[model samples]
Target: MESFPHSSACDLTAEIGDYQQFPNPGAEHAATERTPKPKLRHVRVVLLSFGLLCVLQGILNVALRLAVREPTDAGGTEQSCPQGWLMFGSSCYYISSQRRSWDASRQDCVQRDADLVVINSTQEQAFLTGFTMAAWVGMTDREEEGTWIWVDGTRVDKDRLQWARGQPDGAFGGEDCGDLRTMIDFIGLNDFMCSARNQWICEKTFW
Candidate 1:
């Protein structure tokens, strides 16, 4: 047979060498150029799961709030305190233990989250004065010799005060202190000594 052309033989050898060296170029190139499908799918699944969990938590919170909500009363007001605390209009009252001076009693009330009693109206004053025992009711003349004032710095409303007979008499130099003195008729007065220890009524302003 005639000898083949040199260039053609060289080309045939090069082609055979290339085929042997790289038999699956398409597959290799596809693997290199494309991202890992399994890893991307896993990441997407994790992100979706986290988002769903957050949404569920938010929905649960709203449901709980709705379930536990309290209803408002006819006046659009809600009862603030639980039972046992005496409610007076928009305030709360607590009578502290007996056996403290007027100043000590005021400090005790302050420590207990309240202040000395402040009688606003005649009715309130009358109601408090009717108590059987002579308790402290927040009035005092400690600042001046005879100028009486409430612990909250309110001037005495003469009309509201129901003084017992012969009260504020400055007896035994006792006018400096004010107390709720109950006579046989159960009436009250701003009498008694500042040094005398007695139970005190505390008044706190609430919302």
Candidate 2:
């Protein structure tokens, strides 16, 4: 019943024998499972971890912004006024409890990072009316007689402010410095001597 020659059978058997030492499919699968993963897989894991951290950082930034946001109001938030200062119309006034000559008063204001008050509006005048019966203001005409200017070097718009009736008469040869008078009947602005000692008002405005 044998169809192949004896030599042909022996050659076939030799070829089969050569394959005997080769690993089986199951062994190949086991070896593959035991092998270490590719380095690119580790790099991918690191990248994913970094991406997660970045996302967390972004969330933290958003939380901080929300935490630091302040509520605003219609008239805007009211600013804090320093001690011994009175706030009125976005400004603060420092009224001295003692008296000093106009020049010395202004110097003191300068030392305090402020200047003698410049009355800008009738409302401001009313707010400061009773601070003292009289106080040295920033008005002066030392540079030119009758050409009154504020300490800030701006021309005094005489008409823009109220003057004590018939006052600022340049009385006593020259009343160059100005004062605010709140005495019952004599309440208004008046020109006075620069050397006169009187209470003073310093003003600082905040924007």
Candidate 3:
């Protein structure tokens, strides 16, 4: 074999070692291919940030819904009455359909732990008037011929009494029991006979 000079061979060996240890441009490019591009890395970061924002928004919405909820009554609980009874300002009122004498109707109300309605306010009078049927109230003058009294042993207030036109005439017979009389113009009271059969209203208090 043809041999080079000692210095030249040493120089060639050094060059070969350098080529093996230090990579070329193509090898460097291949190494860089393993690293993620900047644009792609930025896109991944943006997507992660958006996902975190969505999760936070969902949590915030749930918290807002809980914050706006209506509060319940923390004081004494309210009570209710039986079916077919109406609730009006802590009182329960019931209008019966069955007809009975004034005394009999009053006894029925007493058995149910209530009494005949004694209207004290204009609102109550209006409400009672709404009922088309003429019903017996608690007002009566049976104890005295002219002194009106309620079933609760209270004197009747003259100002609060709604008397129909030409009432208390005691036409046909003497009228002692009071009733809600329906007339052409408006609803008012009329003295009715104690033995007359009529529907009645009962009232009681609730919590």
Candidate 4:
């Protein structure tokens, strides 16, 4: 006779139940793995952006330096001649075309905040001699002939005085007017009538 089925339907059901208990990955595992990938991508993007910004800033700095231009004397002190007159060394001189008496010439110089020419040194005397062709200077003895004095009240330095040969002998009744005379190989002095029209020289000290 045929033997009955050794395993019953209940036994098959028990086998299926055991299989279900075995380990199996689910939707939660898939989600956890996908989330980390996007986080890493975001970090990489931020790093790249920061590096690009730094590079751009460095380029701009170099370009700006190359494009700028500077003056040769930039940040240096300015230079200019003295005001209202030409400067020769430490002095200022005014050459005037208007003629005046010895006293009037002194007054004119005073009004201009200067003094009639006072030759204190040989260098100055020489420099002024070049300017004298027929100009009335500060030397005169209008107050008392034979005692010439400068408008600034300084006695004429006799050593520096370049009197012409046996000149200033008070020609024409002790002529008190002083004029600068120029001759060949010599710069000299000439006494003139104070009322004669001639240019004048005025000087002022500068510091």
Candidate 5:
């Protein structure tokens, strides 16, 4: 049997005890700290990036909402005339409430940059009838008696003109200016005196 010296044996035992207590602990601690720091930094970067993306997305959504809220004039919001004016076909009509003579009524229309309604269609005449029982229109034969002409200097065609039965009879002396009469059975065009005070219709073209 081989025998070790007591001092040597004691030294070897001390070395073993020291190794057992430490045993690469510093390397293990260094690896744990170094590895976790990078992983935590990466996680922080990912979190910040996700938050920034969410903020950008929110801003983009708000911008889109504002753009969609804008209005356009082509969407039926554009009107050819001021409020209370009736828009029919390509023209706008305004029925006057105040009664005036034919010349005065026409002057009033001219002041508004319009003229007495020069009805060219039966439909237009019918539409005017719906607004009032009687209104001074543009027709007059004051320039040449029995030769009816519109205010625009256009000759009144027989086919386009609608007259009540036996109307324009030069009734009550001599009839001159035209008026739409809506007296139930007498709902048609009739020549009346130019000086008679009655409501009038004005018209203007727009597109």
Candidate 6:
């Protein structure tokens, strides 16, 4: 008697003489395909997790940007400055590359929502010093001769700040506008003509 070779468990489930019965020829393949594949399941899980992480990071960045807008009394972070501006202490500074008269420089700063940098401390003055050969500052005695004052209406303490030798001499009739200079034997603060063109520094506080 010759018997037929079986390829699957479902084949030849029953046999009688030369007659054969196959319950399900495709049952084995169907059982294997019903379940999710391990590699595909893992890839789906990884993609979902990555998407969640990206969403969380975006939310965190927005929160950080909106948390502290104003500077605190203690101190502030570097994020307070805008793009292309420099951060120092609790203020942001913008150094100009072009030369302009005192009034024009102030106007440019005003357009930028800032004003000529007011040297509030020796440290700040030092930071600004050497950065420019000559730059207009926020101080002047244009209102009252010999009584220098800042644009913010604060009195300029001649003793608190360093000035060039024999400065504010009212040279060439009168030199009322204040400027930071680094000329030969003429360094630190000096009184210059308001119409004289020069580079300038602008400052705006975070608070």
Maximum-TM-score candidate: 6
Candidate 4 local Cα displacement, residue 17, angstroms: 97
Rank all candidate structures by their TM-score, best first, as comma-separated numbers: 6, 2, 3, 5, 1, 4
Q: What does the lDDT read for residue 156 in candidate 6?
A: 90
lDDT comparison, 1 vs 6, better candidate: 6
Kindly indicate the candidate among 1 and 4 with the higher TM-score: 1
- Model 3 ranges off by over 4 Å: 1-75
Q: lDDT by residue for model 4 over 1-207, one digit each (tens)?
A: 989869877676433344455445777688877777777989999999999999999999999966542222334643333456655555678877777776678778789888777767767766777664667778878777677787778777666778766667776656787777676764666677776777777787644
Off by over 4 Å in 1: 1-77, 81-84
Error of 4 at 198 (Å): 1.6
lDDT of 1 by residue, 1-207 (tens): 899756755465433344345459888779866866787879999999999999999999999988655454578876454343455666667765557887788888788778878877866766666443666777777677677788778888766667777667788756576667656764666667777788777777654
Weakest lDDT window of 10 consecutive positions for candidate 6 = 70-79
Q: What are the clashing pairs of model 4?
A: none
Flag the better candidate by TM-score, 1 or 2: 2
Candidate 5 whole-model C-alpha lDDT, 0 to 1: 0.83
lDDT of 5 at 11: 68
Go through the candidates in order and give the clash count of each: 0, 0, 0, 0, 0, 0
**lDDT tens per residue, model 6, 1-207:** 999965986674765586677768598678768987899899999999999999999999999877755455654443467787887788899989999999999999999999999998888988888878999999989888999999999999889888989987999899999999887888899999999999999999866
Estimate, for each residue in 1-207, the C-alpha lDDT of model 2 and write its tens digit.
869745755475433334356669998888878874688679989999999999999999999988644444367884656799887776778999999999999999999888998888888888888879899999999888889888878887778777888877999888999999988778889999889899999988774
Point to the candidate with the largest lDDT.
6
- By summed lDDT, the worst window of 10 consecutive residues in model 1 runs over 13-22
* C-alpha local distance difference test of each model: 0.72, 0.85, 0.81, 0.71, 0.83, 0.89
lDDT of 1: 0.72
Q: Is 5 or 6 the stronger prediction by TM-score? A: 6
TM-score of 2: 0.62
